[model samples]
Target: MPHTRRDHAVVLGASMAGLLAARVLSESFGRVTVVERDALPVDVLATGSRHRRGVPQSRHVHVLLARGASILEDLFPGFVAEAEVAGARTTDALGQVRLLLSGQRLLQTDIGLRSLLCGRPLLENLVRARVRALDGVRFLERHDIVGLTATPDGRRVTGVRIHADGGEQETALDADLVLDATGRASRAPVWLHDLGHGRPTVDTVQVGLAYATRTYRLPQGAMGKDQLILNNATPENQRAAVLAEQENGLARLTLAGMLGDRPPLDPKAFDAFAASLHFPDIFEAIRDAEPLDDPVGFQYPANVRHRYERMRSFPDGFLVLGDAVSAFNPVYGQGMTSAAMQAEAMRAVLADDRDARNGKPLTWRRYFQAIAKAVNPPWQISAGGDLAFPDVRGRRTPAVRMINAYLPKVHAAAAHDVDMSVAFIRVGSLMDRPESLLRPDIIFRVLRGPGRRHPRG
Candidate 1:
């Protein structure tokens, strides 16, 4: 084994990514500490708790991508099984989900990938419980991390400064490594600059998407079937409707639109907006479904990516992962998948018995290089879609335009053909890179598609 064994790893956030990272760290390090800003749930029930102030999008609908469910299952075995026992529906992706892609129904196939349907809070609660079971980790609740505590030479990050119950505390908790598993709103970049490290280059692609979602009580007979009715936005009509049944017998309907096309939060406008989409299954589903609460809205501006891998200087014993490194559009459903991959990447690096991974404090370059391998694929995966719309602005090169042209045809082919369908969904889910869809077989099929995909109303 390589010589570097961390005494502890300090994680900034305790949500999905935070808890997963803490679990991974516990395996490699003797002890792990997660500093979370919000108070964790006292009762382990998967009830729809009010949104935590730390996670602004908790109120929005969050479903695990197929790859994310697989990763979570491997990282914490029987987690999905437990969720299944608790009422999460584990249904085949292609067979169960009714997806209208670009305007057509994606062809059904036995993709072997299953998605776990549950709200964001319930998924977080299950993961938090799993992480807490590890003896090597401890969560310091209500301890908000303010800044990084670094040593002189600016070569290493030893700990973090927090605002805890102790009040304006400057106490230093020593660690062999400090992990920034903090989500999108992390202060890592600013803290890096404060420690004499140059600022990491950032890439932003704004989609300007917004959503208005409200929960409804599902009809009892409807509980067993994987209830996902998705209507995609056509170029002319820039709105989509997504309806899914959660584990708690609650159905969530999120009306999503881009540019200036936002669904109003008023209950009166909800049905009207839902009816305006390409398909109206979701609207029909919720028409008689019992409304649990008034509509809640979430506005996301862009996908932010920090090119830490290309940065010139980074301290040892310090690395940023998850949303602090990249945050994608929730509309694409990639955050948790990318975060799981990031944690798996970290674990693999820790498992490697070589200096190429992490040794005596990885240099800023070496550290981010490892992370870039994980982040770049998902970045391109998300950005490619956002840049598709003429209204969404970004650097659209010839290759991008070429991709835009090809993607529609590929997507069209996927609507009916089985192999192409599974391949496209695999790439879209971030289990594989976008290039994975470019196999010769898929390309030829997209160029000349087999007709007769399953028709959607």
Candidate 2:
């Protein structure tokens, strides 16, 4: 069936969610304007070396999980291949990465889980190039969204008022739809209140997560056996770290701390922090590596979710997705993947019903409902996992308690059993639902215990 085409659509922010949303919206709108407050990096296509100050976390490590990789490929054909050519490294998630969970190291094995490792700037550049080239998609850089223009009665959003960076003029760009992908600092709630609509309910989990990352040039073939190393903080130990292989023989080591604990910026202190991890592989490999940059730190105060699905009334022609909708604890590395999932949800909801394109109020509600469904699992994994840390304040339901209690068993079993490891990775990657961990077979294996014992230092 031929669907109706809209005149124009606007996406706020050019981050992952905004880029993905523009890609999806291009199919149904004649023109899609992406409004970004930060100036677009000039070398995004040529070098993939530039970063926008708006995205401070881009300085740290980021991974495209199995599902996000698949989605990006679907949205932009040859994405992985192009990324690889641009120096992004691909390795089987379970094969090349040393994973330690709950103090137990996963036995080295290939389980067919693939991950795309690269700096966030490089990945963003690739996606930005692809999206910029899409017909009818225009990048409106240096524009900040001030508020939405609405119908006289405030029943529908008509357009958005945007101010050019450092300019006195605020202009209105009319559109059939307005999507807020501006991330955690989204002003949609305030805009809604000013427009007389009730604000969406918000849920928050305080994590107080902090990270310090440094890039280094490894000695040739020094990171021989493994491409990545990860050690997660347990309830007993609130420190974590990951050393990820990046492009051009460069690697990034990100040390993480919780509840106000922070990795030091001094090189010696950072090395000591790495040495203090429960697992020493990261420190042993990077202690003598050539440093390319100083250790930089970023802080995440809490994980937030705007419960738009439960809103009694929302304006038509308005929608919010991506980190604007939910920002998870970065320790889980779920932000990019969650944004991709929300973009995918937008695509699904947009494609499934042609009638929904009529600019009706129900259409936005339906899309928010779908986004809520997509967010549930990752929310459960991140928010639920955060509860495991006693310092993190949250409501721990019976289900949360049960899952937390049983997860250590799963981690212990995964140290040696391939099936258990696979199950855990699958859930972590969002390829499978969290309930998959509760299946009888997995439960039986976890209770049966890890198959062997290995000495620890």
Candidate 3:
């Protein structure tokens, strides 16, 4: 380990994952500093003072999966209560949502993953405000973490040095442990290589996906009742998706497509994009509503994972989490959930290290592998689903190929079969493992039930 358990710990990012990691580190480390290259939003909520930098997909719709939401609430009690009090709408399982695929309504399942909705900034603001109140955790906004400083033996990481206002001074604020909570722009791999440790292995699943989102006022009587409507495109058609509804009565809508199918950046084209969905209700309802912001777009080329867990060796007292390690496309909306699990897994590791020397415990390498176990399932559920498309080229496993082959039927049956819908939605929401979708009953229903030609809106 680097510093004693009482030394300072530094976090490398301040986004949702970074914030969660900082919150947890405060319990063990004496002082925790989070460094971010992008200037954080002063108001973080409505103002979005920090625009379009590191998280370009912030403009796109962000959904906090049910399991992820539960994890966040566990880490910070009364968080869901806080979000509800603030104006975010907590939606019920596939019940409140009107899912349409291939022009028909996905039936309401008895059990579905429940989640909360709001602009990313709004959610971030609530969490950030809570984190800011912590006594030991601190923030260093607009600063860059150049690299990690290690002990003379080069066997452990002691702290981090940041580049600041026209001066370069290495501050040795040692850490009991260091967590790299930085987002996708993380440089942990490069830093590790510089210290003689090899870079983490890499894994990637790519799809030429894009997003275009705009905000609007929910029409009278239409604010809280409407469900998310998605017109998913299978391999047969390259185009896909539309999500429109409430987040604090302030309606937000997005149009997305895969491969070469791109949504328009203009208001007129945006309307056409919505109307083109399997359902016309959502598009018809908002096509004429006032546009609050200019149409914005973000292109996501691939889903990449840094196989840090598979690495041969890692320095003591150093660890990485969240997008810094495995980043998924925002489309699947697994970011926060995966980070929550990472933080939880780390907490368990820290709790188990009884005989830990000074700062960090000795089981640093073990903890990283444990995190991989927690991350892999969700990664498979997400990127695997994305690459199932015709335009998404990859060498897929037989099971992946099987699941991908039958998903359309599962989706089609879900719209008409109650039991199947419940099973599918629960798995999709991360409330359960993907294998749950393979239950005998679900498979029987998907194959034997009346399959709808289209989903209901």
Candidate number achieving the greatest TM-score relative to the actual structure: 2
- Candidate 3 lDDT, tens digit per residue, 10-36? 888888888988888887777888877
Candidate 2: the clashing residue pairs are: 93-113
Per-residue lDDT tens digits for candidate 1, residues 1-457, read 1226567788888988888889888887889999988888845564535567788788777778888899999989888889887667776776677777777667665567888777777778878888988998998988878788778877778788788866765566777788887788888888888889878888888888899998899666452344677776767678987788787677788888888678899998987898888766677677777889999888888889998887777778788889989998777778888898888887777666344554354455655666788877777767777787898877787867777778878878877776677787788667778887677877888988776555432
lDDT on C-alpha atoms for all candidate structures: 0.78, 0.87, 0.75
Please give the lDDT score at residue 292 for candidate 2.
Answer: 94
Instruction: Rank the models by lDDT, top first.
Output: 2, 1, 3
Which residue ranges in model 2 land beyond 4 Å of their true spot?
Answer: 1-5, 355-362, 452-457
Better of 2 and 3 by TM-score: 2
Q: Model 1 — TM-score against the truth? A: 0.93
Best by lDDT: 2
Worst 10 residues of 3 by lDDT: 43-52
Q: By descending TM-score, how would the candidates be arranged?
A: 2, 1, 3
lDDT of 2 by residue, 1-457 (tens): 1123378899999999999999998987889999999888756546565668889999899988888998999999999999999999987877787887799888666767678999999999999999989999999999888899999888788899999888889999988888999999999999888778889999898989989999999877665678888899999888999889988879999999999999999999999999999987888889779999999999999989999988887788889989999999887788889899988988887777655555553366788889999999899999999999987988899999999999988888888787787789889889999999999988988999756553211
Regions of model 1 farther than 4 Å from truth = 1-5, 46-50, 165-168, 219-226, 353-364, 452-457
